[model samples]
Target: MLIGYTRVSTDDQHLDNQRSALRAAGCQRIYEEKISGAKRARPELNKLLDHMREGDVLVATRLDRLALATRDLLELAEILNRAGVGLRSLGEPWADTTSPSGKMVLTVFSGIAEFERSLIAERTTAGRLAAKSKGIRFGRPPKLSAEQIALGHRLSSEGTSVREVARMLNCHHATLYRAIGTYITPADSN
Candidate 1:
C-alpha cells in the first residue's frame, strides 16, 4: 500500500498539484492538510503515519512536502523504517527507502545533517562567547541598579532592618541580602 501525504502552508496554497502527483505515482490513500511544514504538529500527517503498516510505503510529492528540515525528514524516515514501512518522494526518486541505493543516499544525508547541526552548535557557542567578551549581557536585566544596591548597603549600615529596606526598594528581603552582602549585620540576618 502506498499512502500519500500532502500539505499546503496557507489558505492561499492548494494541495491539488501534490495530490495529483501522488496519485500519478500510484498512491492508494492520500492524506491532505493545510499547514506549514515548519510546524511539528500536522493532524493529517500524524493520521497517515498511524494508519500505515508493515510493507506500506509512505509517499509524498516532494521531500519538502513531508518536512522542511533534513533532520525532520530523517526522523520521519527512521519512524517509518522502524515500523517496517518505506518512504518515497515522487519528486526525488533517490529518496525511495524501499530500494538499496535510496537507503544509502538517505544515510549519507543523515550524516550531513548531523555534521551541519554540530557546526551550527559550535558557531553559536563561539558567537555567544564573543558577544560576552564585548560586554553584551544576555537575559533579563538586574532588578536593582548599581545606585539602588549602594542605597541598600547604606541603609543596612544605618541599622535599618533588611526587611524594611527591601520593602522600601519594592523587592524581596533575600534580594537585599544578596545585593548588600557583608553590610547585613547578625541582627539583620533574622
Candidate 2:
C-alpha cells in the first residue's frame, strides 16, 4: 500500500503540484491537509501515521513538506523504519526508504546532516564567544534581586512549587531553574 501524505501551509498555498506528482507516482490512497507544519498536532498526518502498517509505504512530495523540523523528520523516519514501513519522497530520489539503495542513500544523508549540524553548532558557539570577548554581554539582564533570590530559596525550601515561585517573580521557568540547578524539591526536601 502506497499511502501519500500531502500538505499545504496555508489555504492559499496550492497542493495541486504535490497531489499531481503523488498521483503520477502511483499513490492510490492520498491523505492531505492545509495546516502549518510548525503545529505539533496535525489531524491528517496523525491519521496517515496511524493507518500505516508493515509492508506499506508512506509517500511525500518533499522532506520539508513532510516535516517541519529536522528532528521531527528523523523521528518520523525512525518510526516508519522500525515499523517495517517505507517512506518515499519525490523531491529527494536518494531519500526513498522503500528500496535497499534508497536506504543506503538515506543513511549517508543522515551522516551528512549530523556533520552539518555539528559544524553549525561550532560556528555559533565560536561566534558568541568571540563577541563576548569584546565586552558584549550575552543573555538577559538579571531581574531578580538578592532578596528575591533568597525568598525563592526560602519558599523552595518549603512546600511551594517552582511554578508558584516563578509566577510570583514574573520570570520564566528556565530562568529560575538554571539559577537553582538542583534545589531540594518537595520529594527531596525531606
Q: Which candidate is the best by TM-score?
A: 1
- In model 2, pairs of residues that clash are none
Write candidate 1's Cα lDDT for 60-103 as tens digits. 88999999988899999999989999999888999999999999
RMSD of 1: 4.7
Candidate 2: give its CA RMSD in angstroms.
8.6
User: What is every candidate's alpha-carbon RMSD to the true fold?
Assistant: 4.7, 8.6
Q: Rate the local accuracy (lDDT) of all candidates.
A: 0.90, 0.85
Residue-wise lDDT of candidate 2 within 35-116, one digit each (tens)?
A: 9998878999899989899999999999888887876787788889999999999998878898899999778767877898
Number of the predicted model whose lDDT against the real structure is largest = 1
Q: What TM-score against the true fold does each predicted structure earn?
A: 0.76, 0.60
Model 2 ranges off by over 4 Å: 112-190
lDDT of 1: 0.90
- Candidate 2 has a TM-score of 0.60
Candidate 2 residue 131 Cα shift, in angstroms, is 16
